[model samples]
Target: MRPIGIVSILREQTPAPDRSFNFLMAAAGNNTGNLLFTHAVWEHLPGPKERIGFQFDPDKVNATCRAVVFPAANWFGAHVDLADFADRVERLDVPVTMIGLGAQDHDFTGKVDVPEGTLRFVRAVAERSRSISVRGTYTRDILARHGFRDVTVTGCPSLYQPLQPDAERRLLENAKSTLGPTLLHSTRFSARYRAFVDTPSIHLDLYRYAYRTRSDLLFQSELEEISLLVEAAKKPDIDDALIATLLDLYGAASWEELQAYLHNSARVFFDIPAWTQAMTGYGRAYGTRLHATIMALNSGVPALLVHHDSRTREVCEFADLPSLKASRAALDEDAISKSITRADFGKFLKTRGRNQETYRAFLADNGLL
Candidate 1:
C-alpha cells in the first residue's frame, strides 16, 4: 500500500536525547499544543505515512504517496504569510487535504484581513482537495467569502484521538466524577500586544488561580517557559534575569516561589502519549489554550475552555465542548466548579458522536481513511 504524506515538523513521537530548546520548539511548531493536533492527524490517518515537512518535493510525494495531508493551524489571519506554502501545494499532482484550518481574530464578530498569499494557498488546496475540513463555521464562512464552497466543519482531529467507541462515555463519566487537582493551560502574555489584547489579564488571572491552588500549569509556546524547563532539567540553576522576567510577566509572588513552582508544578511535553497520560491523572483541566483543552478531553478528562478569541470560541462551539467567554469566566474554584456542573455532557456526547462521523466522512472522501 502507498504511504500517506503528512506535513509536520517532528518526525517521531519521542525527541532525540540531544534535543535542544530550538529543536523542541521546531517540533512543536513553536507551540507545544501543536503536537496534540499534528500527532492526531498523523496517528488517526490509516496505513503507512511519511513526514514530508512543509517544503516537500511535490513530484516525490506524488510518486510515493496516495495523498498529502496538511494538519493546519490558524492560517486565515493577517499575521500569517502562506505564499511559499501555496507555491508548493500548487505543484502537487496528488490529492491534498487540510484538516482543522482555522481563522484567528480578536472575537467572533471581528473580520480577518486575509492575506493574498493565504487566499492563493486556500485556492490551491481547494483545487486539489475534494473538500477542506475547517475547525468551525467561522473558518468555513471566512473561506466562503473567498469563493470556496467545498469547505466542511469537522472541528479539530485531536478531539477523536482516543479512537475508542466508548470515548464519549469515558469523557462523560470523567465530567461527572469528583473534581481533582485541576490542570491549567494558558498562554503567556506578549508585552508588545499587552495594551491591545485582553490576554494579559487572562494570563494573570489563570496564573493566580494555579498558584493559589497549587495546581499544575502547562506551558505551550512561551520561549521563556521552555527555557526555564530546559535550564531546570539541565543545569543547577536557571538564569536570575530570566526568572525575574517571568515573575513580572506571570505576576508571580516572588522569584524564589516562581522558580520553585517551575521545578514542581509547571509542565511541558514533547511526546503526545506522555502528555495524554499525564492528563489522565488530572480530574479537570481549564484555560485559554484550545488544543490543551482538547488533549484533556482526548484523555477522558473534563475540560472547560476559556475562549478569548475566535479560533478557540468557534471550535468549542462546533465540538460542543463546555466553555465560557474570557470576559465572563472567573478564575476561582467556585466559579469553575459551577461552570463544569452546568455543562451539558449529554448534548456534548451526541454532538461529538455526530462530529466524529462527519470527520470520518471527511477523511474517507479525501481518501485518507
Candidate 2:
C-alpha cells in the first residue's frame, strides 16, 4: 500500500487526510485511482490506509507515492486556466489522471450556456491530460461536439462512492409508510422564477428559467404563500408532499400541533446522525435539489427530480435518472397529479442502477478500479 498524494480543494479545515485518498486512488485508476479528491464533492470517504496530503513534499511523493488524481474543478477561487494548470502538473514528471467535471453543460430544457473562455480551457485540459473522465453522456456528447476527441471517460461522482443495493433498499423498506412519495426541495429557490409565476399562461419562461427548477417542485412554498390570500389551496401528492415531509423529518412537524412539538424537539436532536437518519427515512422522493435527490436514490428510495438548472439536469441525465419539468405549468394540480400517479418506482431504480454500473465500468476500463 504505497502512499499516494491527492490534490483537491477543501475547506482548509480537514482534521487530516484519511482513507479517502486510497479509495479515490483505486477507483480513479492505477495512476488515477490512488489519489483522493475533496473537490466539489462529499466531505469524506473511509479507507483503512494512510495517505499523504499537501502537507508532504514533492520529493516524499515521488519517492513513496503510487500516482496522483485531481479533479481541478473544485468550484473554488479564481477561474481555472486549464492549459496553465495542465502545464504545471505535466512539468512535475509524475503520473496524473483527471476527472473532468463538465456538469454545467445542460440546462433543464436540455440547452447549455457555452461559458466564455470555457472551450479554450477544455482544449488546454485536453492537450495536457494523460486521460479524461466526463461526468455524463450529455457532457461527453457536448465534448465530442466541441472536437474534444481526447481519451474522455464517462463516470458520475454521485455514483462514484457506490452504495450497496441492500443498504439503500432497506432504507425504503424501513421508512415509515406515512412518509411515502417524498417531495424534496432545497433552499435554492430563486426570486427570478417567481416573476414568471405571476403571469402564467400568457408568459412563457420556464423552458428558459436557466437556474430555476420547474415551478411544480415548490408547490408547498407556493401554496403557503397562495394560502395566505386564497379561499381553497391546492393539495400535494407524493411529489409535492416530499418537500413538506422532509421538513417534517427534520422536526418541522406533520401538522400544526406537531409543529409546536418540534419547537423544543431540540431536546431530542443530535447533529449529524439525526440528519442521516432523517434522510434515510424517506420511502419515495421527488426532489428539485441535487443532493436531496441523490441521497434518496442512494438510499434506495424511489426519487423523481425537478430541475432548476443545467447542473441538476446534467447530473440526473448523466446518471440516466429521471427528471420532470419543474416548470410552473408543470406544477399545476393536473400535471403534478399526473406525474405522481405515473411515478414509475421500478424505472427509477432500474435506470439509475444501470447508469451507476456504466460509471463503474468507466472506472474499471480506465484502470481506476
Q: For every model shown, what is its TM-score relative to the native structure? A: 0.91, 0.55
lDDT of each: 0.80, 0.43
Candidate number of the best TM-score = 1
Off by over 4 Å in 1: 11-17, 163-170, 174-179, 189-200, 231-242
lDDT of 1 by residue, 248-355 (tens): 655687977877887799888878878877876788888999988888776767789999889988998998888888888888777887787777777776888899
Note the residue pairs that clash in candidate 1.
Answer: none
Residue 106, candidate 1: alpha-carbon lDDT = 81
For 1-369, candidate 2 gives per-residue lDDT tens digits of 553345553322211134242332222321211122232223322222233433445465567656555553322112333444433443443455556465453233434445435555455545544456775565666667667666453444644444435754553343334344334343322223443344432113321121123222221122232122222213223244444543333333344543333232211111223333554544555546555455555655555577655555666665655566556335332454455445554565566577556555544544445
Off by over 4 Å in 2: 9-64, 71-84, 103-130, 151-155, 164-183, 187-275, 328-341
RMSD of every prediction: 2.9, 11.9
Clash count for each candidate, listed in order shown: 0, 21
